[model samples]
Target: MSNIKGKLIALGGGDDDVLLKLIRSEICDIHSHIEVIATATTEPVESGNAYKEAFEELGCSNVRFMHIDEANAADTTDHIERISKAGVIFFTGGDQVRLASFLNSTKLLEIMRRRFREEEIIISGTSAGAAIMSDCMIYDGYGHYSLIKGEMKTTHGCAFIKNVFIDTHFAERGRFGRLAHAVAHDPEYIGIGLSEETGIIISEGNQVEVFGPGVVTVIDASNTRFSNTREVEENEPIAVEHLIMHLLVKDYRYYLKERLFQPLTQTMPKEEAGNVALPEK
Candidate 1:
């Protein structure tokens, strides 16, 4: 597979919705002109066009909307052709479970893999769309600070990015609980908690750059010192320690390659400052 050097962003819900400025910024950096394609995974036939209007506001003449639900209406080759040829693909936020069920093992998923592999194609998702980027996705809600049992479910993400668990509307929704739950269950992943209107661009070098108006929380437990809550039951507060979370703000960059953080302009802090010390795990 080719190196996926193209810019890829996972945005929280409330992105520059109608203007799509953030989305356009990523696309225009690589391509002179962008061909925007909108896919609605959650909407019914009646309301699917809602996202399409968002794309139209960017004033791209070549914007096309493809209903993945309509993939069954056409042959597999047609589906592949439509997706593979696009310059940028945008997945609208809604029910991520609905999105996964419709796209998994389908021609659309394959083409998405191919498009990323070939280079110059940007893939972006927001909210439920953002949640679906992880290999293990949170499909449904279970009250607060919870997930349905056996609901520690796994699904096919676009795999544009890997080993990273994503949750959107992070700060606003108090989603720290959701992301912490995911990391606690599986410590191997680095949880990406995106606040509303905020996004993080994961470059090919694995660098995660924060964008938009809010914060992108990075929960790094890969080298956690301790956790003794294995026997603990669900919804119960488990103890943990040394869980590192860095808030990446706009114009700041976190490079995954060097494992270093840098501010966009000088006079800003080069080293990340915040470290969450949880109860012993």
Candidate 2:
């Protein structure tokens, strides 16, 4: 991650005016060349056109989209050429398992990673796209059963960043257990659970600035003193001690290198986060 020269974003979906404007001003201007990758969605054309229109609505006329199925996953003739021309690359939501597997070890993926590391290109994704940005990704897991020893499943991801795993639709889907399990096992990586209508923009390959209306849960297992994950059976519940969790809101920041959280200075303040009023029954 230290070598990365790009901006990486993990979005949890929905069209927010703030997010759109952020892309326009902070990410890329309307004149910047953008490429939308629809490899995750089964309906590539539909997803691709939708993003194209969204960008166009933001006055980004140069936005183009393409689908990389198994057929063309390795094509270097046109696909590779297009990537070289891109200033910002976006991935749409769909099946994360399919996206990672389809683009695995391909020349297309190779160049994309290379450009991301060497250039100031912005590489971003939503939902499944967001989930595949790490080297290890959870392909299958239910929130309800994730605490069990062997309930979660992971595979090699695109490796845009190392020692980190991402999960999308956090609040709506109740995916805390799965993320907990992942970090508990790995212990070194941080598990980021991004809720819908929310996302994080990773800058300098170490810090992430949270955006949108929802919460971003950061699961850190680095301080663990005890864990029975090594002794638990398949259906048995696994218990781990000292699994640290951080809740972040809009404008908050988290540093991957130091494993620290930054509350927007004096704007909202970190102490106020715990003072949220509960909903009346």
Say which candidate scores most in TM-score: 2
Q: List the residue pairs that clash in candidate 1.
A: 207-256, 227-281, 228-281, 240-279
Candidate 2 wrongly placed segments (more than 4 Å)? 15-18, 264-281
TM-score of each: 0.80, 0.90
For 48-155, candidate 2 gives per-residue lDDT tens digits of 988899989988879888668766655668888888878888888899988888888788888888888899988888889899998999877797798898888889
Q: lDDT, candidate 1, residue 267?
A: 44
lDDT values for all models: 0.64, 0.82
lDDT of 1 by residue, 171-261 (tens): 8777676676567656766778888888887766266778777888877765566664466665456666777678889888775433446
Q: After superposition, how far is residue 71 of candidate 1 from its true place, in Å?
A: 7.8
